[model samples]
Target: MTDNLPLAGRGCVVTGGSRGIGAAIVRLALAQGADVVFGYHSDEKRASTLVDELRAAHPDRQCSALQADVADGGEAERFATEALDRLGRLDVLVNNAGITRDALFARMRPEQWHEVIGTNLDSMYTVTRPLLMPLVKQRGGAVINITSSTGLHGVPGQTAYAAAKAGVIGFTKSLAKEIGARGVTVNAVAPGLIETDMTAAIPEDKAEFLKSLIPSHAFGSPDDVAHLVCYLASEKARYITGQVIEISGGLVL
Candidate 1:
């Protein structure tokens, strides 16, 4: 591995890495010379394909997958343990797992709110809680949480999603302060309307309208978010923490 690959000799764990932005993070982390272990909820085939593809490219490094609903504390514990065992040590943790159940508050069911919160916000605690000691014991690491623009500026129909993502920001900042002395860094990346399976749900007209709001007049790709995450996880970003950096092509600006 070369010096340019900033994450050389590191071990990374990403949740919900079967597809979309999560998948991109996994690919980039591996490319940067990190042994990676990722969790996926259901998509076994997609997860297997990604593992195979990444393993083929970096045969010397470890690439592993664990099937677990990270929103559940028990499952998250199991996932973290297995990943640590496989990678030997943890250097970075990316909380990229999330789900959106969009609706107007008046019509939003309790299940929708709970589900979104559980998967997006609560999963942060579930997954990260189990891994905190490992990171702190290591004496240094990076924690990157994948938030959304809707969290920074609320959207009309994304009450649950907005709330969950916003919670992620709070979690990131608070955790950063709590762990800073241990040489660990915690930060958030708020991506705006990235071109992913998640955004594929937006109606064509609505998607176009959203793009018009961005100065770039275009949607971002998963790689856009991945690049930022890789930087945050590297030694170069050691001085940066408890900050929310948006990768939205000036959408919020």
Candidate 2:
């Protein structure tokens, strides 16, 4: 956050930054003195407001918003180009855009499966590929993928979502090995039952029941995950890579 902090002057790109976890990441990174560009799917109003707010908060730092659906390969590529162009440099990339089409494996439609994979899994490649050269050329950068605990524990009735997120875990590990030598680091953050609009879709009773399983008897917040993200993007974590760190208040443990 300061001149001595790892994130100072680093350029950051956060997907799905209009609200929830991605928004939190944008705010935290900006507060830490990182120039930030956040991507949104549809909510241009909120995205605009966030950019305005951040500009006010960090008057001297670079802050802006971009619109792109990481689900679409072509759009993802364009988004990366625009982000790099607008930010001038990119030192950290957060793959936080995702969607869920919940249904039992037998009931899940083909469209549902494709949508989940495209938005959650395929976007990792679609988005990251465009930035790879720039990151490698710059000599170093960090890539952080956001996956759910469902990816690890295999949640029932969310076959499509689970599979795609699980793929992110493997993708992160493999990509890390390929790019670490370039001074780039890739890792995945798997959150357990985080309190977000995504979780709000679940029935309240079911959400309460899940909370009981958390040792803290509470759901994790966007800021909780943001903390770990900031840490991983810091020099303190330079030695950490190719790992899937869970922040579930001991929910997964």
Per-residue CA lDDT of model 2 for 119-167, tens digit only, reads 9999999999999899889878899999988899887898898899999
Q: Which ten residues in a row have the lowest lDDT in candidate 1?
A: 1-10
Model 1 residue runs over 4 Å out of place are: 2-4
> Per-residue lDDT of 115-203 in model 1, one digit per residue for the tens?
99999999999999988999999999999999999999999978999999999999999999999999999999999989988989999
TM per prediction: 0.98, 0.97
In order, what lDDT does every prediction score?
A: 0.93, 0.90
